[model samples]
Target chain A: MTELEIIRLYRSGQQEKAFNLIVENYSERLYWHVRRFVCSHEDTDDLLQEIFVKVWKHLPSFRGDSRLYTWLYRIATNETLNFLHKEKIRASLKFERLSVEMEEKIDDDPYFNGDELQKELLKAIQRLPEKQRIVFTMRYFEDLSYEDLSEILDTSVGALKASYHFAAKKIRTELKKSSIQL
Target chain B: MGKDILDDLKRNPYSVPDGYFDRLKGRLNEIAVSSVDTVPRSLWQRIRPYAALAACFAASFLIGNAILRKTAPGASSSDQFYKELMYSDLIPVTQPYAIFEMEDEEEMETSDEDIINFLIETGVSVELIAYVELLED
Candidate 1:
């Protein structure tokens, strides 16, 4: 089913049908979207499930002002940021660096099949400030348009562009510092 | 940094367990049922914070009143006492009690009756005042 049909089915009280269509259509997309931010497949799976649960609960309140997919994207983004923030706090309470934990998760993940260069790129991405990292993920990995990002991030297109530029620069600088060529 | 690399980055490098999407809808069905089961529990969770705030408000109200009522008997609260209250970490709030300070003592006096009247005017029940009075007596 198309996205609109799913919303229609949901609004008409065919919640189970609507939700199944949603998962079938968008689950993999969202799983990949979440996975870029959190490198571990296990954590990505956990977050993807949480995102769908939130979508189920809050889908009724969706105002249809923007594309339905963009709304879903916004929810995924918010949940990912919140999850990272909580992890930061938890790690800090234990005197741990969140980036160090992330790098370790990347290393320990059996699901990862990328080469060393890809891993280095991921480490560079993780070292970024949270907002910059998110902007970069949405732009670089998801290939979302700046207008779509503005709608989801509630920021202006110019600001999103600047954030992306800074994120790319920082990642490139970090890569060079670590003797990893792009 | 090239367009080709950016395109490559857009391709997802992550994978999930086999049959993950096939099983998700069923898991969500269980979630829907479980969410329904936890409705009453969630309602309590929603109510918990306001309930705690009410408890804190009531405790502070009683404690503040008690402290005011027993300010070293016959030591007539000085201007410094209320000043300390204003500057102290505790009770930075503006209240009827602040008006009853020693600066106004000569004009109005900080007697138990004045405190009772103040507390009553500020919404403390007269019954509570009489109960505290009985305790004092």
Candidate 2:
């Protein structure tokens, strides 16, 4: 169903149908958005469920102030950051350092099927500061407009552009140093 | 070099575990049910610290009772029962959980890199952040 149809269904008291449409419409996009930030398939799976749950809970109050997908992305992004925040805390508390944890997870991840360059590229992206990493993924990979990103991030357009520019520069340094070509 | 990096990075090198997207809706629906039970979750969160304190008190009480019983004159059958209760309650489950939490609390540290990098500009003022938070609640 279209976004409009989902909205209509929701406003008309068919909440389940409306929510299912939301899941159908944005689940994959939100999953990828989450996956890039978290960098672990298992973590992404768990976070995706949490994201959708938040979406379901908040859909009733969704006033169409912005696009539906944008709102969903905001929720997805916030939840991903929150999840990563807790994970960083958890890792430190247990003496399982994050850098070490990421190394082990990358090695053990069943879904990391990329070749060496691709793997290196992901590692480079991983090394980007968390917010820059997010900006890089959404801008460079997802091709979202700065206007849209600013809406979701609640940041100025110029700041986002600067972020992506610096992110690309950092990523380029990593790729060039590793001799990983496009 | 810049263009080359963008081109490579945009190649979409990631993949989810098999059947991940296919099963996503089902999984989401299941979680949504639990999240909707907001009352229970908030109640539990509010009471969690109290619950932990209560558990500690119970543990200490049992230990103290056992120590007194050990020192007192003719040990009754009830002494054996109380000793058994303390051993059963403290050793296998409660003690380990408390120890784990204690260790976790002690080691709660944050990485410097994480603090340095969380620099996304949220253009809202502190008051707006507080206001939005209020509206959210």
Candidate 3:
């Protein structure tokens, strides 16, 4: 279903039907988006559920000021950042580095079928500050345009471009430092 | 990096368990259609972490104060007495009764009623204060 059709269905009081459609249409895409933030399948699964629950809760208040997909991406982005922040705090409380823990999770994940280079690239991505990491992942991996990123992140297009530029540079430097060829 | 190599790497390497999407769809649909909200934390659940953190800070402050009292110059007999009480099996380590035991006699004039009132004013539950009072008894 198109975004308009779903929104119409929701506004027409067929809220459950609209939500189911939203889940059907967006879940797989969102699952991958969230999976990139948290490497573990388990964490991704939990986060996806939470994200959808949030979507459902706030759907009534959705003003359609932006494209539905962009709005959805905004929710996913905020949820991912919040989850990461909470995890970071929890790790710090235990005197552990969240990045180190995430790298270990990536290494030990059975479902990660990436080659050595891909794995190293993912680890380097994890080393980034959280917002930069998300920008890079969305831009580089998901191939989202800067305009879309600007909408989702509420940043200016110019700022988003700079963030992506710096993120890519840092990833390249990190990969080179680890002696991994581009 | 060339666009070709980056595009090649764009192929997602992650995999989910077999039939996971189908299961997830059904689960999410149920959640969406259900009247009960499933995700936001309850007020207590949200507050629990900060509460526990504050409790930890309070405990640490009391323990550190006890240690400082024991090591400070011209330690009093009361400080020694509390130190012995802390080390001995008489009072549980968790019971922070020494918080009320001040080094200066003037500060010692601060009564338990005043302390309990301060704790109540500071948002401590009556149950906890009553438990502490019971410990004092």
Winner by lDDT: 3
Q: Global lDDT of each model?
A: 0.80, 0.77, 0.86
Q: In model 3, what is the error at residue A70, expressed in angstroms?
A: 1.0
Better of 1 and 3 by DockQ: 3
Cα deviation in Å at residue A120, candidate 2? 1.2
Candidate 3 CA-lDDT value: 0.86
* Cα distance off (Å), candidate 1, residue A30: 1.0
* Cα distance off (Å), candidate 2, residue B70: 25
Enumerate residue pairs that collide in model 2. Answer: none
Residue-wise C-alpha lDDT for candidate 2, range A1-182, written one tens digit per residue: 77778898889987776787788778988888887777788888888877777788788889999888789999999998898789889998997766567756776777776767767777777777877888888998788999999999999999999999898889778878787344
Error of 2 at B117 (Å): 91
Candidate 3 segments exceeding 4 Å error: A177-182, B1-7, B36-137
lDDT of 3 by residue, A75-173 (tens): 998998899999999999999999999999999999999887788889989998767888899999888998999999998998888888898888777
lDDT of 1 by residue, B1-137 (tens): 45433334445555667787677656755655566566466777989999999999999999998887877534546766656655565643566475345344477646877898799899999999899889989
lDDT of 1 by residue, A1-182 (tens): 78888888888988767777777777778878888888888787788878989988997898778888999898998999899999999999999999999998888888777767677778888889888988998888878999999999999999889999998988767766665344
Task: List iRMS (one decimal) for every candidate.
Answer: 2.5, 2.1, 1.5
lDDT of 2 by residue, B1-137 (tens): 23564465466667765686778877776655555555655888889999999999999999999998886544656755655554454566635665445344546676644433443243446566556558879
What lDDT does candidate 2 reach at residue A113?
67
